[model samples]
Target: MSSPQSPQSPQPSQQPKQGIACLGVLGVVALVVILLVVINRGGGGSSDDADASPSPYVPSSAPYTPPGDPYTPTTDPYASGDPYSSPSPEPSPYTSGTCLNGTLPDSTTAQSVSGVEEVSCSASDAHYKVIETVPLSTDLSRCNGNPRTQYAFSYRYTLNGATINSYVYCLVGLGSYAR
Candidate 1:
């Protein structure tokens, strides 16, 4: 406990080991910082494999058609008729007494109803057929002052299994309303 040759603390010759260990830790930290700097410098930031570049700003153009312009009508322009003339009668494709799956004759088809015995909803077999079509009179007197005279055509559809009387009424080309 009282030996003068040996000191209470560690000897001076062993101090270099402490310094070496501290310096080694600092050297490893410096190497890690240098490696991070070199790796970041090599990268372009914009991922080339993932395609992170901003898309180009492109203004869209109108769609093109070959034969018919969508803005123009297909009807004959030189036909002798008034531009504001009244719409033709029975303009609707369907009327009352049409089933859900039933295919009724259109205005053009019904116009020549005298020729068509019945219209077939089926392409091969008889699925639904228009049995009878009678043109009712367009009289507003039946409906007091109401323009419901569009109920002019009476269509009847029949399916072999008990008749599903799904009556659907539709009329086109009523004159412009008093709006």
Candidate 2:
């Protein structure tokens, strides 16, 4: 029998396949470059160009407060008055005369005192001293409209010597005064 003819060697031509593959890759690369250029061009416009003609902003006139009369003076809500000019009423002298076992005098009175030179306290002795006597009015009418005046006398102390401080308070108002 004649030997079967060897199958034709597979053609070794790779150039056409390589060329087609290269063309496909080049096509994809070109598409990407074109897309990038379009995207960059689109992103270049700015809001500044749109606002090039800035209109002058004019504020509307506020409700006019017809120039000052006593009833319409500009009063500052947070303004404070001189403490000395309008002194608060003094609190009553502390009737208890001694600090209670676990209590101290209220600090408001201490602050209101006209002549408190210095205050000192010792933890061991549980004592306090105010170098100078502070004068305060205990009458409520004097400090009316002020809540701080009400409890002003509830706490206060004067250091006596080294081991004792006297606690004191004043009666604010008599019921008769309310009438």
Candidate 3:
């Protein structure tokens, strides 16, 4: 009788299993490649048919005007370069109507006020222009700051021993708290 065989390691059977596993991985890789190719080619509208230069689509009724921005207030108006380099774009904060007091004093006309204290008009707290004339009733409204003073024109001199155009007073600064 043949001698009883000794228990053996599983190496012989493992070889076939490893071969099958490698084949299975290769099969999956090939399947994925095939699927990707099919999807890329199968889209109903191919990119080849697209226009070379796509234009912005606009409605037919009217000529397209790029939308104007709804007004938004900034913390500082003179935030840009030299203040005198370009004219400031005067801002309108009030939406409902013009403020009381009345519109900006006629730039063409010279006006004056008396017993008024002088202000820097360029100070931190006084950084705005007359966008609207505050109504007298609304002059002290939340939007108004401490009624800053500015000299539209101030001169003290005598021509023929008389003072002319000696002084003019105007309020400056945007008092729009609602903004």
Candidate 4:
């Protein structure tokens, strides 16, 4: 009888295993190439065909106006026929008058009082003759440290031989302060 073969010897079946692995690798590569070709083919569109199509119709009623074009001078309907006509001058400031016995001439005019030593005036308040007229001095320190640009008339009268000082607290923007 022949001697028993050794178990560590090389086997012939390993050659077929290597061939199977190579075939699998080649198949994957071919599939990837086919996918790439299909994708690239769909993206290629003819530019000539796009230009041959009919363009969209636009109405001629609205002509294209370039911004660089010179602007035409417009005639104002309220303007006088004369181009050189001067604008009307503004009305003069408040008119000064004398007060009789602490009584004011018209309730609309401002007047000074000696009792409280305070100046007060209002259209709704009783008309009183103004003793003296003085411009209001505004303080902007309370306006968030910002300068006060505008002010409305608060008091029409001032103390006799005494000066009155006015102050503005809050500012008005967008109906109130920005913050």
Candidate 5:
């Protein structure tokens, strides 16, 4: 019969290989632990780090100013000292007794005219005198066919569907002029 086989021992080279593989695993775990410690050390907002410098990300207390002139509100025309102030009535430049110079375009018949200049009644060049001033209306009956009424003129300015200014002049011939 063959001699009884002795218990086999692991090869020396295989033993060293197992040892190196275990050392590589340990090295990886140690490297991970060191990285975690480094990250936590620099992290912000820990109360325990009382003397730590302020973070660069914090905003300053001063207000940020723009490059150009600062914003300013425009003047309000409606505003007065009184909070309940109402709009004052506009005074009409052509009143009932005002005289005007410059010849009429249609001197023979009563008609609407323009380019008339205001003058004193005593002025030598005065050609027409305003007998009555009134608000303009669609009907001409107010200034039409009257014996003394020589001409009628309406002036007005409108902006954005609203009348900004308006006037109607009912005039009579002055001097030797006839209607």
Candidate 6:
């Protein structure tokens, strides 16, 4: 038969459990002390050292100033008036009765011609002679039905999307320069 145990004192079987609990508490206390020592060692300096030094960055309060006026307007030489003076105070070399030395396409299909220059009517190199002048038109119909006119030449000048000067010349073939 077993005897009853008192509440103030533990039984022999429970004594081992209390000893194990005390060892667990001592292990937790030791771990906490070790963790605190490692954290303090990893810190580079004390808090007092951080407070003694001044910060490196400082802000400016004065307004900024630029060196020169970068937004000034520039001057365009051809903006004031008509840069292409068609009918000048003096007579133009390309006017009627004058001659031009240049190549004309064999096809009478009417096309744009370049590399033509003014020449004297009597010159041997003169290919075509101007018979009439038509202003602001390159239309072949302007020279149509004219017996002496074999081809039409036009001139147009523009500045800044605006037509400055335009004209057309009625040409007559000279010698073997037909077509």
Leading candidate by lDDT: 6
**Residue 16 miss distance in model 2 (angstroms):** 1.0
- Model 1, runs deviating above 4 Å: 1-9, 43-50, 55-179
Task: Give the clashing pairs for model 6.
Answer: none
How do the residues 1-179 of candidate 6 rate in per-residue lDDT, one tens digit apiece?
A: 89998678656978899999999999999999988888678654567875696768765876676667656546664777776765453245377788999886654456777888888889999999999988777566787767788877776666667766667778989989875
Q: Report the lDDT tens digits of candidate 1 across residue range 1-179.
A: 78578657867988899999999999999999988887678653445745666889775986565786877878866586777775553334343333223233433222312322223333343223222233342232332323443322333333555433322333322223111
For model 5, residues 1-179, the per-residue Cα lDDT tens digits are 89999999877898889999999999999999988888688754368677777767766687799776656546554465664775454545688889988766653334655677888899998888888776754234567655578776665656667777766667888877646
lDDT per prediction?
0.43, 0.43, 0.44, 0.41, 0.72, 0.76
Q: TM-score: which is higher, 1 or 6?
A: 6
TM-score of each: 0.23, 0.19, 0.21, 0.21, 0.42, 0.44
TM-score for candidate 3 = 0.21
Clashes of 5: 0
Question: Which lDDT tens digits does candidate 4 get at residues 1-179?
Answer: 99999789788899999999999999999999988898678655567755786879989799878676456545674577666775433222232332112221222223333322112332222233322233453333233343431211223223554544432222221112112
Better of 3 and 5 by TM-score: 5
Q: Is candidate 1 or candidate 3 better by TM-score?
A: 1
- Report per-prediction Cα RMSD to one decimal: 19.6, 18.6, 19.8, 18.4, 18.1, 19.4
- Count of clashes, each model: 0, 17, 8, 5, 0, 0
lDDT of 2 at 28: 100
What is the RMSD of candidate 1?
Answer: 19.6
Name the regions of candidate 6 deviating beyond 4 angstroms.
1-93, 106-110
Off by over 4 Å in 4: 1-8, 43-179
RMSD of 2: 18.6
